[model samples]
Target: MSETNSAMTLGKRSLMGLVLGLAAGGALYFVPECWLRDDFLINTVFKIVGNGYLNLLKMTIAPFVFASLVMGISSATDVRQVGRIGIKILAIYFVTTTIATTFGILGGLILKPGAGLSLGTFELSGQYEAVESSFADVMLGFIPTNIVASFAEGDMIHIVIFAVFVGVAMSLLGTQAEAVKRFNEDFANVMLKIVNMVISTTPFGVFALMATTVANLGFGIIYTLAKYCVCEIFLFFLFGFCVCGGIFTLLARENFFRFLTQFIRKVAMIPFSTSSSNATIPYSIQFCRSIGVSNKVASFTIPLGATVNMDGTAIMQGMTAVFVAQLYGIDMTWVQILTIVIAATMGSIGSPGMPGVVMATLVVVLSSVGFPLEVIGLIVSIDKFPDMFKTVLNVMGDSVCTTIVAKSEGEFDREVFYGRKAAQ
Candidate 1:
């Protein structure tokens, strides 16, 4: 009862913050330039508060994820079972991403968002440079030569790899490593407690972040790219509802709408406001636990999903390819479409989960099919809107994936998941 009440109160507060921020920020955008100066309000006040809150979330990620992974794997019944869970999770991620990308491409084809517009109508600045890394590089970068540096740098891929190594070793050591396993479990709990502390301030943080975004972008940009934005946002929901929710329904044998309500009631606003999958990890795990996913599965899957799962990013990249092709009057062949899918899928894996970084991933996808890089400039202006929605999709994907896998592994508590009993 207490847990439910706390979640309810937090949800109400966070939703209120989101609404108030949008209202305040949108109204502020219409203020006279002399009264509402960017230097004083948007850049100074909003930037500081928003980034400070974001930093608080980032501060917990490296240590929290590391400890969770260590504890989750160390406490597993068997090493082979850990490997099996990993394989299942990866398989689901791959399928979902591919589906998301396909849906994005099909949406672009059907909607033709850029068909009527000429390339000269919009400003083309090839200002974004994609730091292209190959699949080989991404794979090689996973192993950390120095674990301390990985944590210091907040390199999630390396952190995940090192933690897995330690976990496997502890699992193999049996009774000799029991004390270390307990320490990891206790440490994860401590990190989660800190995360809870940070989460309580979400409403305030969300308000500042939203206010800053609206003050800068204003309403016009969203209107300017209305078609493109609409298409992207539609795909986000389509994928989230049809793909993620469908998987949950098919596997969990529960009502997806019910699940959706519960999900939104828990952590929807954080991802939407922050535009970050990394920042939402702790909350995703917490939500999973609330629905009866085991700590072991929740800890392992949620963190890994944050690192590798990029369904939303994949969707964005795929749509961008078609949108750019249409804008440039370039006819895309089957070969180019295939290239987009392949590149987008591989690019999303190990990609950074921070806001706006997906633009970098989009560069790789566009470049793969020889799309003009300048088209990215137009997308950049309206990227935040889609970024907000896509982050929500990505985070939801993480929770759904965690829950489904938990069910399959018999790690799910049906009573709690179905509301027959409250989470203890």
Candidate 2:
């Protein structure tokens, strides 16, 4: 075969190998105990590859997030535009998050998925170290004491703030700073190239992540919380598809389902598998750009959305709170429900860009409103399942918010929004 054809064949083989590996790992998870003990080689291969993939993804996260944020900020035109976009983005983020949490709470109340469950003392193995930052403290945290330290710690908010300041300074210097701006742009491209290199191995990582999860914690965990899981999934689809779609349709004067189908065809799988809003940032940014949202709007809104606009997390918080309350037979007053909405909304802003951060924030919010802390453990076992769905909604929310903001700011292309086939 010619070199090009040989390379293409090898690429297809590699892709198939990754898929087969994942399937084999998943199958091993359901193998009989006797078979598992006899199949030592099979178990060894599955464990090593699956665990190795997760570590690789984790390794890339800190650098990818910091670099992506820095690149985004450095590309902005001015601090004033950044500030304006920040404010608008945050406003929409908080409002929609509050609305999402409310829907979750409302759904929980009506569904009562956890109703009549007996209270049990459950232990939480996952420990979250509290970063003591009030609203003012969080604001102060944005000003990095050391850029390297911020990047090392993966403090996204701080990185974003520092990048904005540097970007502003670059813009101010104009002719003098052109070289620096160009260098930064090149650096950003290099980092993105690294991200692409890492993402190319995603199928391997995903297979391992899924295999380990299934093998260790079987589908039994989900079966146990079957009702609660069903209710949360129902609410997620309702709010994400029905409610958010309706708003987009009304605003854009187009069929919401059609728009969703177009967008989802591009982004649906990434968030579903990764279960992270931050990880999906690049995809969300590209999706916005493809739909004709300007670079300025896409960069500003997508990063900010990843940081604070957590519709899926909000929904989980509301529903999980009520689910726990029902499981523990705790009576929640009207005032308590209102408090949940407020706390969940605020918590989304403070929550770290980690997979289970919302679960930690949920404990804080629920405890603040007089719910038992042990109840959090009950939800933890089933957290990953709902989290996957929540992440999809989170990305969807960011895209919708970006589209709306771009439209209002006159940064959106009408033709692109209408799904015309053409280059961006």
Candidate 3:
């Protein structure tokens, strides 16, 4: 009971912070430069609070990811159960992500958001350097040469690889590894506590972030990228509601609107405001559980989805590739468009769920198709605005996949899904 109350309090306070912060930030935008300096206010004040909160969340992620994956796998009933669930999750991810990428590309081609714009129209900031990485590079990068260095650097791909090995070994050992399993489970609990404490401060952090974002760029930049933003938003809704909702309806055999209402009530705000799906994992797991997903499935799928199932990021990358291509007057062949679809889908896997990181990953997609990297600078400043919405979509994708996998594995409770009974 106390835990439920605490969660409710946090949600209300966080929402208040989001609204107040946006209002405060917008008001600050109107302040004269002489009265309130950007250096003193934005770069110093907002940067410290916002980034500090994010850094706190990042700190929990490494340990949490390691411990949760270890616990999720080690505590499973059987290896075949793990493998079966894994197959289902991956299948859902691939199909939905491919469809999402296609939607994004189609939106870009249909909208032609960049057709009227010239490269000289927008001030492109930062050095746009594309780091070309092939599939072999990604595969090899998954195995860590130095596990210690991987943890220290917060490399999730390496951490996940190591965790899976440890988990599978423990699962095989069974009772012999019981002590180690308990230790990992306890450690995961500790990390969840830390995450909850940090989540409580979300209101303050989001306020600072929104305030700084508005103060720095205001609404002018959004206007410049309005068409591109609109296209992305449209894709998010079309994919989130129509595609994802359709899947949930067909697979879960429940009403999508009902699930959506409960999802919004339980888990939507955190991802929407924080723009970090990793930060929202604990809440997502709870939300899944509330809808009757079992502990084993929820633990494994939500965290794994945090790293791999980035439908939202995939959409943005696909659209951006086409948008940037149009901006530079570079006509991409059908081969290049196909490359964008494949690259975006693969690149989104294991991509860090951090604010504005998509701008960095888009480099790989753009490079694959030989799009102008400099065009990325045109959208970097405004990435944060779209990032919030993208994150909501990202986690919603996670929950949908989690629900479907849970049902397939017989780990779901239909009564809870329909709100006829509370999850126990």
Candidate 4:
């Protein structure tokens, strides 16, 4: 087959997989009692296929992250440039994350969706133990003690730091590092290929995940959490369209909606299905680069953004805290709300990029402010929906941050930023 034809074939297969997966998931929801009663079916086929896909995606994450970071760092001309870019990226990430948390708090305060609601006795699982490490210890730990352990434990932050060091070291060596640089680049490309191969099955993964969630939880949960879900979605649109859009417009002096048009479909899909900023990193990179952001900006910012900056998660944490407070008839002072925002922002940064991590981290943040865990437990059962929306916002924030940084660095194509499509 011609290369073009082969690519098309793969695209078709991916789409077909998504449809089949969704269909299968939907079918499971209405399956006969006997089929549903089979514990093996639930534990084996349904759980395995859905959860297994997530595990496989996660399995590739460490290598992909490190390889991409190595490739990004090696491509940098100097440490000074890397430092400048890194600082800017982190600043944007921190500021926007803070804002996201604030936005959630504001939304929750205004909406008060959980007012007068009572979530009676519930048990919270997965208690997170605080790592006794100090700030210095946390910083030091960013350098992997053992590379293999970082991957085994899914330590994204450590892997990212290690990749950056390798990249910078390779750049310092110049031509002497040619072979290593070439090797890292080749390795990253190969990993990306592997990622593509795995992501082709995303439809199936989404289907299984959705079906299992629907069957186990049922639509009744949505009705119960309808107000909460509505409030959360409102925050998603408000942040994505208003807050983030405003930032991009002020910086680029362009229409934010127009800028979003080109990549909305691509960015929106990953979060809805995968509900992970980390899983969506590959697509975010592709989308940013396509829209004329330089490799330097996209590579450094997007990956780091995925790790440290999750606006959606931040927003969810803040709002959920307020919701819990309201549910328990606990009136939070301004001081308490401010503390929740700070805690949520910090917790999100420290949170790992995995399913259930954000929810757990939010619980930690809320608990710090004396919010009830029982309410958090109720939120957890219906987290998948908000998770999807939050992932979308997180990815969108990354893209916006990249665009602004690229523009400031003179690495952005104004035409493309305002253009109808990303550069080919």
Q: Could you give candidate 1's per-residue lDDT for residues 276-395 as a string of tens digits?
A: 788888999899999888999998888878866878888888888888877667766665676677667756765556654465456557645546654453464456667888988898
Ranking of models by lDDT: 3, 1, 4, 2
Model 1 lDDT, residue 25, Cα: 79
Better of 3 and 4 by TM-score: 3
Candidate 1 pairs with clashing backbones:
none
Model 4 misses residue 306 by how many Å? 0.6
Local accuracy of candidate 2 as per-residue lDDT tens digits, 1-424 = 2422432333454445445544654576677776553355345655465445434434554444344444444443434556766666666776888999899899999998877554543332221123343566534533679989767654434444565576557766767877877776676567555544544454454454444444554544234477888888889999987778876776645566765886689887888766667778888888888877888889878877776678888888888888877765666665557657766665565343445445445644664355654434335434567777888998899888888777777888877766675536
**lDDT-best of 2 and 4:** 4
Candidate number that wins on lDDT, 3 or 4: 3
TM-score of each: 0.60, 0.59, 0.61, 0.59
Candidate 4 worst ten-residue window by lDDT:
122-131
Model 2 residue 187 distance off true place after TM-score fit, in angstroms: 26
Cα shift from native, residue 253, model 3 (Å): 1.6
User: What is the C-alpha lDDT profile of model 4 across 1-424, one tens digit per residue?
Assistant: 2433443344455445544544554566677757444476666776787666655655665676567657654653344557777767777888999999998998999999776545443333222223244556534544568978766765545555566678779978888999988887888778766766665565455555555544554544345467898899889888898889899999866667766887676667866666667777888888888778887778777877776788988988888877876665666665566557766775566344545446435544655554554344345445656677787788888899888888888888866665656575
lDDT of 3 by residue, 1-424 (tens): 3554564455566557656666777888888885355777777887797777766656666676567557755653234557889778867877888888888888888888777755533322222223355667544644689999878865545566687788779988888998998888888778666767766676677677767655655654345477787778888988999999999999988788988998888899988877788789999999999988998999988887887788998889888888887766666655556667866776676455655446545655765554555444345434556777899999999999999989888999988887789898
- CA lDDT, candidate 3, residue 35: 32
Per-residue lDDT of 334 in model 2: 58
Off by over 4 Å in 4: 1-81, 119-224, 420-424
